[model samples]
Target: MSTASDYLSRLISFDSVSRNSNEPVSDCVAAWLQELNFEVERTTYVDPRGVRKCNLLARRDPIAAQEQTLASGTGGLAYFCHTDTVTADRWTGPGGNPFHAVFENGRIYGRGACDMKGSLAAMLDAAQSISLADQMRPLWIVCTADEEVGFEGAQYLVDHSAAFRDLASLDPVSIIGEPTRLSVIHAHKGIVGMRIRSQGKAAHSSTDMGINANVAMVPMLQTLLEIDEQCRTDETLRNDAFDPPTLTWNFGVSDEMKTVNIVPDHCTAWASMRTMPGVDGREIVERVRRRAEELGLSFDLYSGGDPMHTDRDAPFVKELCELAEPYIGANEPHAVCYATDGCVLGELNRRIVCGPGGIAQAHTSDEFIEIEQLENGVRFYQDAIRHWCC
Candidate 1:
């Protein structure tokens, strides 16, 4: 197999930030996979901001290995990854370059190196290592866009990509390479978002003509605070398996009119909350909606898909634990505090989150993946491919 670091360097060079179109990165990956005899399909969607995003679904089948492959391969293995990273606006990598990949002190430094591009490199290299003729089942790879902003690309793929639906019919064992430091992740939290806004007439400071939209936002903000407190106090929503053990809230606010001389004609407040597995995220959504209706403020609510969870004792989970733990010196699968494409691709019921690098380095100004993790991730994926596909 080609070295993962080499592949990573090339991938890191493509600045596929979530806010920008991922065409360059997506096109590159699609071409690379196609060159390796994988049948690749490209799908696209327009983001809410009107940016054109892409998703690549690539597959390899050994017609000579099994008659099932000649027809519809009902069981195989699938690897999931995203092509986008958070903004590189705060990039502080070597020489103030985020797209220029660098190897320093036993780590690879670049934007998306740890967050996900490194994982993508490993997956491709591992898949390349296995010969098509030696594999009895199909191998599928899914690369989606906009994972950092939201799972918008994944959601679009799930809904529109016929190739994605075709692969899903195979009941493939799923692996989400989301920087778990190679420790198998059995579950993680889900995200919920709400946006509230008010509009009023703008005017001069001395004028009574101004309707003062800020006045309406006050009641909505207060209600959100009360709900946040409610979530913090709700023991039923707690999950001790995860750190912090409860749902957490993040609030963002802005007003159109910046000067104090005039009443703000437009005010917007948005909130993000993470929902634990087995917790009802809709409860919060419902409460926020009722408050908006009461206050007559326009509001929007979106669930970023359900929390992902696979039974700890499931056969696939056990096999993954046995295969991946020694490299990390860990014994069992664990839970994380973040969501992945698994939340959106739930139809592939057998899923695990395991990959190189730690989540702590993800999306940071100075992002990097330990060399050890990157190399081991390559071996882990190779082992998994041989065991599950070959």
Candidate 2:
């Protein structure tokens, strides 16, 4: 098998779901990079549920070896990919088993195949063609954990990784390989999720002593709808760069009472929206929070991050766009609705979300990456490595 296919098959075999320990995947990646003589560093942390998550960073820095610092968008090139896959309980791909990766009809079927083990495989295969002696600058490969969850791995690395800090110093071009279909991405939306709760005394449904907290969410839901509509119509609140050009707001409330006869005391509703780069996410959030407080509801922010925006006209973007011409052919750097680790690694000056495969295939019951895209991805990454590292 080709190195990319071999590495991809091996990677997909590991059930590195976000909720489980990623040590096995990390171990294999570390070993593979080490075989290429790259300096490997690991940052390990336990998630809230005590799952052992590990982030791996490997780099080949010829200048640093001689007591100097060098960096790549290809300063030195750093390819960031997440090791965690979403829960594959719904997987019904050609393999029948999510972890066994089935190859047929010029496609590889499995969990994380397109949503990004394929991209990681491409990076691994591409790196093999470039040795340390072939680089005047540096090359970086970062396999992070918990990206599918909340970018916790990238955030943890930002807070605890020394090597990451050094990479930031170069202001290197950072590419988050996030199923962008190999297009150069200069911007994307961010996530804003929160839970709102209301408290009331419980009593019999027929008795007045019981308070139905569910009634409190009526007005709050109204406020959210208003914001959603305004976002949809208000040019000032929307960015034309996005497809929907709105926050894409969503929320729901679940009834906790087992029986309708008993008065329900607890009610919780969650509303999540996206943040645009040029828009003020704070004001939008404040509007919802204010309504929740006025209605005597408890509001808590669980997930929130600013949209990533890198100048499309930047030299680094231009170079990538030019290089991607063979694939996308003069298509301007695009934007996506999804969020990525770039939300956490915002400090890196030139950041883009570019990778193989389509988001259309991700998180589906049957996830796969086309063999042609995978092979082209290998060539793309290899050329990028040469551009930034050599």
Candidate 3:
């Protein structure tokens, strides 16, 4: 019988960096669920070399035996949590290894410990504590891979599953257990991360035959600045739930093609757009594309994670609010600028992002989750199951 803290520590110890396969952690979760009498489903996504990465789903039905008593109209709930964390970089410190789980000063320090795996542990602990014989609706626990790189695992699950075909009729509600500091999040902005490449002929610096990629980037930067301003000032697009009303854009990565004496032949800039709820992401991309064409630049754009929202007054939201009351004090429904796996699940059911740790602690150096919060999360999940699923 592993406690939530014990499970979280074990989970954090596995080096499931987003760039690396999460097979180790995913396999451990599969085995644990199988031991709990769940019928586990493992969906594998193979790399070119034939190495397999996976997303695990476990299903349990208390109503299976009570079929005559429960009837066909009974519905269920789904829980989603990610199994990957970002790559530990220079910011993670000299001695920092994101895979190492250290418990000190009432907190557990590690990479995924706070960003997500903590919530996964809490969900598992809660499920194990409750007796399936008393539950009314079925329970689906899904541990998805590749959430950090992109939500590929979740996308595969939703696109390839017949179980999710009639999701609205089956599990009408979904809880994506992100680190929300116990708040119930009903809405969040969308994001599209893309790269734009600029090409020019190479020439000696003395000969002005080559175009400087850095110089070519000026107009694109200016256009993005204009778009950012519009995102800030648009009244209808603004929402108070987020700190700054509208969306924001930033150039996250950039690289110039060459050395000091050579005029570079090409330059590439990677940019990301955080779109507001009412704004159309495709429209924004098109506007950028138009600007790039006018500037005689060739660009490549990739888009994903569209804006999503669930009704604030839905039964699931209400249930979450009631459960979070004692711990977080009358939780207020709100929106966030950061994106989560909820966008995909939103298409299936009414999805809400809620959990124990604060987003501030996520993806930070010496990242840690308070032990008290982890304990509270276990109880919160247990109560949610008892009140709603049972």
Clashing pairs in 1: none
**Which candidate number has the best TM-score?**
1
- Candidate 2 lDDT tens digits, 173-243: 78888888889999998888889898888898988998888888789888877877887787787888998
The residue pairs found clashing in candidate 3 are: none
Residue-level lDDT tens digits of model 3 in 1-390: 999998998998888877778899998999999987778887788644555678887877785455742466555667889898887674463236677778788888888888899999999999999897787777778888877766777887777765555444575467889999888898887778767777777789899787777678778888887777776676765666676656666764354544678887777767677765666556667888888888877777763677678878887788888889988887678888888877666566568888878899888877889999998999988887787678
Model 2 / residue 287 / CA error / Å: 1.7
**Candidate 3: residue 27 Cα off by (Å):** 0.7
Positional deviation of residue 68's Cα in model 3 after best superposition, in angstroms: 5.2
The deviation in Å at residue 341 for candidate 2 is: 0.7
RMSD of 1: 1.5
Model 3 regions lying over 4 Å from their true place: 46-52, 63-71, 91-96, 166-169, 207-211
On the 0 to 100 scale, the lDDT of residue 169 in model 2 is: 84
Q: Compute the lDDT of residue 90 as modeled in candidate 1.
A: 78
Off by over 4 Å in 2: 63-65, 68-74, 203-209
